[model samples]
Target: MSEEVIQYTVAPAPPEPPRVPVRYAGFWIRFWAYVTDLIIVGAINGIILLPFIPNGGREFTIGFWTLTGVISTIVLYLYFLLMTKFSSQTLGKMIFGIKVIRKDGNLPSWSDLVFREIVGRFLHRVLVVTNLLYIVVGFAERKKGIHDMIADTRVIHTNK
Candidate 1:
């Protein structure tokens, strides 16, 4: 029998660029961010009415509720406008080092913010079925709430 030898050459693997691991914030942090926002907005409204609180024992009236509704609307509008225009961060978000940005990582437009804040949020608040659906959809997504999807935005940790 003749002896035979075979040689095999292996190809070099292509070089890959190093990747920086992305860190996502947890649910608790996001929840706290919402709490902070609520507190800040509530405080603003409280401060606005602090001077008008009567010393007498007058029961709250329909006018009071109406005033409150108007103030709340204005505050919400201003909050959304400022966040969309100024790097997608409300005062609470800025404090928490979280910002809202488009899913593609771009600044959100005015229309997007308005739609998310007004229409999406209103629906979420009004329709119980829609609210449940929103929660389910948000959890089903990569942690993006319905409003975030409607606005094409995401909340990311700026400190990271």
Candidate 2:
């Protein structure tokens, strides 16, 4: 009895689509964006709260905390919080063509925004050492700052 040998043929695997490279915004660009944001915030506060400030936004009402200070803090927090929530970017970021994104590639949740914009940023500004933590973005592999690390976020350049 002669047995015929059968050969099995395997189909070639499909080719994967080319991956687009993600560009992380570096420290200087982020710094400039932050400066722009500060200017914008300053303008907003100047226009809206100038009359209410006791001593030209420098009066200390409670242990270095003035009415202007308090109001500015509130506005600052609200600006970051609302802008990131609605647009995933502030006006400064828009000008710079950068945006905040979650590392998991999902839409950022309310908790993420609060943690990043409010708690993390507050910590950075509240302490000198923490403020320096912003420098980490320059060294981090993905260009994440302390706030981005805390919130599992990253700032990336968006296609304009």
Q: Which candidate tops lDDT?
A: 2
TM-score, candidate 2, is 0.81
For residues 72-145, what per-residue lDDT tens digits would candidate 1 score against the true structure? 66786676567657767877677878777666567777877876777777777666787564444335455677
Off by over 4 Å in 2: 1-19, 55-64
Give per-residue lDDT, candidate 1, residue 148. Answer: 72
| Backbone Cα, N, C clashes tallied per candidate | 0, 0
Off by over 4 Å in 1: 1-26, 51-65, 127-134
Tens digits of lDDT, candidate 2, 41-76: 999999878788676544658776777778888999
- Report lDDT (CA) for all predictions: 0.68, 0.89
lDDT of 1 at 86: 73
